[model samples]
Target: MTTSYPAQFLAVAGTRPEVIKLAPVLMAFAERSAEAKAALGVTGQHRNLIDAALNLFGLTPAFDLNLMRPGQSPAEFMGRALVDLTTILQHHQPRPAALIVQGDTTTATAAAWTGFLSRLPVAHVEAGLRTRDRRQPFPEEINRRTIGLLADWHFAPTPRARDHLLAEGVASERVLVVGNTVVDALRWLQQRLTEADLPASARRVLDAGYRLVLVTAHRREAFGTPLRNVLLALRDLVMSFENVRILFPVHPNPAVQEATREHLAGVEQIQCVEPLNYRQFIAAMSRADLIVTDSGGVQEEASSLGVPTLVTRDQTERPEGVEVGLVRLVGTERRRIVAEAAALLGDSTRQTRPDRPLNLYGDGQAGRRIVAALLGDANPPPPFVPSIIPTNSSDECRYESTQDRCGFQWSGPRHSRH
Candidate 1:
């Protein structure tokens, strides 16, 4: 647990979720200034969407790569991020001992790879999430797996996530079940939010006494027909229920905007407007009677608030919600989506809250656990007990590369598996 680098850690964030989830951990690091310093790196992949989240938590990046470009393909964007991140790490004074990236954005994946190539240990927050079928959440599924492969420290947000990493050959000792930081963020926002501070749209909905249903859908796999169908289903819900009010904070992406405009435009009891700021978005989630979205963060946030949610995806990595009956996966099929929403609407009328609040994600202390690990203040797991037969009974066999050694291979400083 000793290193040459200073008592400082590097944090990289790009998307809004990354900003939101990492903010609490960064705040914790800042509080322990005598212990460690946090150096933030913003890839600017999400630009405007990231600002509100950062501002809400009072975070300003020390290293702003400013690498976003409109209309760039994922490969193009990732390539540029990798290059810029390399340059940033190269010139960073008192180089960071570990690089921290949250979730599975291109910025996270690229930064993790860059840190690995630079010989810096990487800590992946919200690690070990998987949908099994990579294509379901294109790029993200593969990205999370890649980070798990390269990360020296995996801060899994759940016991299930930690188990996934262990099953994938990540040393059990390297993974910690710290709970999801999204819950931490939700708890933070909920404490500070009120109806008076809500945006005019959200306040109006609440003032009018309509049962709010917050909707958000902008996943790579959910584009085109899936997006269209979800919108259509929302249209059906608004028309079918007079008291149901739907608030969709449409993403700025052209595909998302065009679809929302095309399918949901002029729909009664539905407000499809531009995206809201972090507080406003939280206000919407806080006041919503039922949540409908394909967002990973929303699933965690809504469930954390005890709101019943309908996930508009075929599968979700955050299955704890689904398992607890707080979230249901109603894929993009219009009939299923409409039916689930309608049923939920009826169910919401019958019950004011879920059967009970499920603290499936976190108890609002994941930030402290993450900070303890980053500062090396937490006790390390006991030494791994390797159970493998060597191919050759020699020191070279133990020290050699995986290809040259036995079936068991050393994965990290503390990782070895059969």
Candidate 2:
């Protein structure tokens, strides 16, 4: 009864988001039949953040590249990751059948390219996201596009994402619309989290009945002036409203730390604590009144929790939340951020409708579907089909007659093929 499985897949993760998104897929692989052996490779692009996420998910990387350096640029990281990943693919015993890279990080791009060069198939998870403008997200847009070119299999999160890949000439059979794995990660963590697990500052804000505004804005595009605008806006919001408390989990980048100290160090209402673990962050999101962030993952997580979010970017690759009125793009202007946050905070009636059924991003089964597809299952799990909910039309939502979930009846073509 002991069946051995070869190392058929090598999953690479380098950032916190990558680890969080990929954890469920890795876990699913373990749950599959013995032939579905998959291994993890860590690049240490986000060092402490990556380790925290891996520990939270109880995952250990088979190969730890440890390629991070102080204030390393994307180009530098790419060069180093490319060299090391190439060596691993070429020399490691039990050579993997394919390379798995999740999301659009420098590590993912480098690893995918290396896999292609080493004559291995590449699978791109969370693929086909696009902001159209390559420079807006500063390399992420470009990075994902490049991965799209090199990847043999594209695991898109939504139908829209699948369309993006198809329009770009990706073969129809090569793409599958698996819902985002973030929802899977959230579902797994929600069972283990409680209100008691929230950070002390967050708990105080909620217990005292003060509005808690969770803020996270650390992106390459928002380094200098844009970051300053966000910090100044937060400072202004807390100063203007006595009952509003800002809980910011600061990133450890030197530039971000320096700017945060310069602008928000002494602010009493704004608590600039160290970065939170994944569990703490999810707990905070569940209880937060409002969230302002420049992170794509936060957008997906907040939407799933039905939390209102203000994205501090001009463009977002994740537009599913925006379409459902759960999120708004406020850009990185000081006045705009303050104005939007003030409006949401001032109006107690403004809330994401609990019954709106905004599962546009996912329904927490993405991991199983992805694993089945990678293993070439003869009967793969059905691709995720999002309920069609129209923007600005609450009356359009209809409950499924047989199920407890809500969705609108759509007359358009469906893409439920596996």
For TM-score, the strongest prediction is 2
Model 1: which ten-residue window has the lowest total lDDT? 392-401
Q: How would you encode candidate 2's per-residue C-alpha lDDT over 56-88 as one tens digit per residue?
A: 999888879999999888999999999988878
Pairs clashing within candidate 1: none
Q: Evaluate residue 385 in candidate 2 and report its C-alpha lDDT on the 0 to 100 scale.
A: 75
- Model number with the top lDDT: 2
User: Model 2 scores what on Cα lDDT?
Assistant: 0.86
Candidate 2 residue pairs in clash (backbone atoms < 3 Å): none
Model 2 / residue 145 / CA error / Å: 0.3
TM-score of each: 0.87, 0.91
Give lDDT tens digits, candidate 1, residues 1-418. 1223333799999989999999888877878888788867799898869887778888877767777787788999999999888887887768887999999989999999999999999999999888899887888999999998889999887766776787788887788878788877887887898866677887788899998999898898988998999999898888888998988899988889898889977886888878998888887787788899989998888876677789999998887667545689989999998898888778523434433333567767788788887778757433212121222222221211134222224333431111
